[model samples]
Target: MTHILAKYLVDARYEDLPANVRKEGVRTLMNWVGVAVGGSREDPVKRSIAALRPFSGPPQASLLGRTERFDIMNAAFINGVSSHIFDYDDTHLKTIIHPAGPVASAILAFSEYHPVSGKDFLNALVLGVETECRIGNAVYPNHYDVGWHITGTCGVFGSAAAIGKLLGLSEQRMVWALGLAASQPVGLRESFGSMNKSFNPGRAATNGIFAALLAAQDYTSSDGMIEAKRGWANTISTKQDYREITEGLGQRYESLLNTYKPFACGIVIHPAIDAAIQLRNQYHLTPDMIARVDLRVHPLVIELTGKKTPQIGLEGKFSIYHSVAVALIDGAAGEKQYSDQAVRDPRTVALREKVTATIDPAIQPQQVDMTITLKDGRKLHKFIEHAIGSQEVPMTDQQLETKFEGLTDGILSQAATRVLMDRCWQVESLPSAAAIAQAAVPQG
Candidate 1:
């Protein structure tokens, strides 16, 4: 399985990808850039930049939304953190891995160091996403159930595969890189809610770059570290399906499964939020309609995001009650809806208290059953079979542009944001992939 993946990573070409797959890569890149820049001024990002600035080796790569640059690896780490700070980055729903942060962050940072063309960059992005997601598929329920953050645990491989491809690592060196990455899995579910949640993906990005660089120098690691009896699979998960990693390498692209978040919070709550907003808008129901919202959701929704009253923005992300309340009242669930102020708002709190969720084994993770009971004795219900951002109902290009605008509105000048958006959409044609990162910086 390792050898097969290495060959695919090393030999895959941009032209080999189907047009839609190539386009999906662009979508992932666009969404990643928006989230990274949007979260650049976040507390976690600010503190990380402040702490690392003095010791940063060299300004070799640009930070996505800020003017500061750092050595390639450090830049990868910071950008990865920023991309995931809002919990709004793209996700491979099968394993719930945020596909771009570790892979794209490392590759784009490496692009600055190596001058990679846009076509090559896109190819690397697709391969990297595929690598992590496939590995994620193999160990998902077990690995995730055991409290490992699947993105950080699996993302290092994506990062290493991407950077290794760019560095032209041989099959043997690529195997070594994967082995090294395997030895450095990151993030625990217990860390969710703190800045460390975002740190996992960022550190995975840096770890991958570290592994690849060392492998390029002929640093040795056990080649079977991923699937060996005592290797990552057996050590980290009780069940292993090697076919998930080895099957349909070039034919099936996991990057195609990538889903972007329309709401800025956790994906598990998206279905309920979608249903709530739809009901609010459809009936022109205001929060004052004197209603209680009832939700029947998948068991994981309550397990992962059942917070009844979230005191902070990060905690708000884990609160399905808060998500539905804000969605119903504001008709949106963007970052503002999950803000510290929003979480503490009296109106939000009142509505949130009226919202209740119960686990329904019949409901799918992407589906929700919502009932809004009003003072007028009118009961309106919506059963969302699939959330808007799910693969079944993806956001349109126009919708994605709207999201990007919202994220950048107050941060980047209109002209700068427009330029950055254009660069991201047409990234495959650029002479250098770094242009997108350069354009993302806020203009004074």
Candidate 2:
């Protein structure tokens, strides 16, 4: 399995990618930059930079949305951390892995150290996402059920494959890179709702770059590190499907299936939030008008986001109670809705207590059954088949642009944001991929 995957990654070329897949690659890049730049000033990102600055080597890459530059490895780590701070990065729904944080963060940072064409960058981006998601597919659910954060664990493979591609590694060297990546898996499900959650992807990016660099120097490792009896799959998961990794290498692109979040929370809670927003807008409902809110959703919704009361913004992102409350009160669930102030707002808290969720085995993760009973004895019901951001109902390009603008509003001037967005869309035509990073930084 390892040999086949390495050979495929080595042979894959930009000219072979389908147009839609290439387009999604740009979309992935665009969304990732928006979130990274928007989150650059968050406490976690600031703290990370401050802690790493003294130890960092020569500045070789720009940290998106901030003026400070760091060495490629440090830049990749911080950018990966920034992109996921809001939990708004692109998610491959199948594995719930935020693909770009690990792949894009590494390659974009490396692009500065070694100039790469826009086409090559996008190709690396697509292939990286494909690599991780497929590996994730091989050991999902069971791997995830065991408390391993699949993104951080599987994401290293993505980072290795992407940076290794950019480094022009031969098949043998690429196999060694994969073997090295197999030895390092960061992140735990317990880290969710805390600063550590963001740390996972950041560390994955750094680890991947480390693995690829060592391989470039002809570092050695067990060739079957991923498929041996005690390898990553067998050791980390109860089930392994090697076919998912080796089958349909170039033909099936997981990158195309990536989805951006309309709401900045766990993907499982999206349906409830979408229902709340729609019902709120439809009836002009206010806190006083709502009597009791009831929800019947997949068991995972409660298992993942059952926080009855969230004290901080990050915790709020993991609470369905808070998500529904804010969506009803604000008619939207952007970054502000998850802030500490918003989470603790009397109005939000008061309404959040009124929201109750019941697990229903029949309800799919993306579906929601909701009931809103008004103070006046009026009852409203909404059943969402698929949330707005689900692949079934994707956010439009205009909506993506709007989301980008919202995230970058005060961080980057309107002019700079527009230029950055244009650069993302036209990334394929650009001579150098570094222009996107340059546009992401704030201008005086």
- Which numbered prediction scores highest in lDDT against the true structure? 2
In model 1, what lDDT does residue 54 have? 92
| Candidate 1 lDDT, 1-444, residue by residue in tens | 787888788888899999999999999999999999999989999999999999999889999888898999899999999999999999999999999999999999999889999999999899899999999999989999989999999999999999998888999999999999999999999887778999999999999999999999999898788898999999999879999999998898899899999999999999998988888888998889946888998999998998887899999999999999999889999999988999999999999999989888999988999999999999998999989999999998888989998998888988999899999999889999989888987777
State which candidate has the highest TM-score.
Answer: 2
- In model 2, the runs with Cα more than 4 Å from the true position are none
Candidate 2: how large is its RMSD? 0.6
lDDT of 2: 0.95
lDDT of each: 0.92, 0.95
> What are the TM-scores, per candidate, against the unseen true structure?
0.99, 0.99
Give me the displacement of residue 219 in model 2, in angstroms: 0.2
Candidate 2: tens digits of C-alpha lDDT, residues 35-79: 999899999999999899999999999999999999999999999
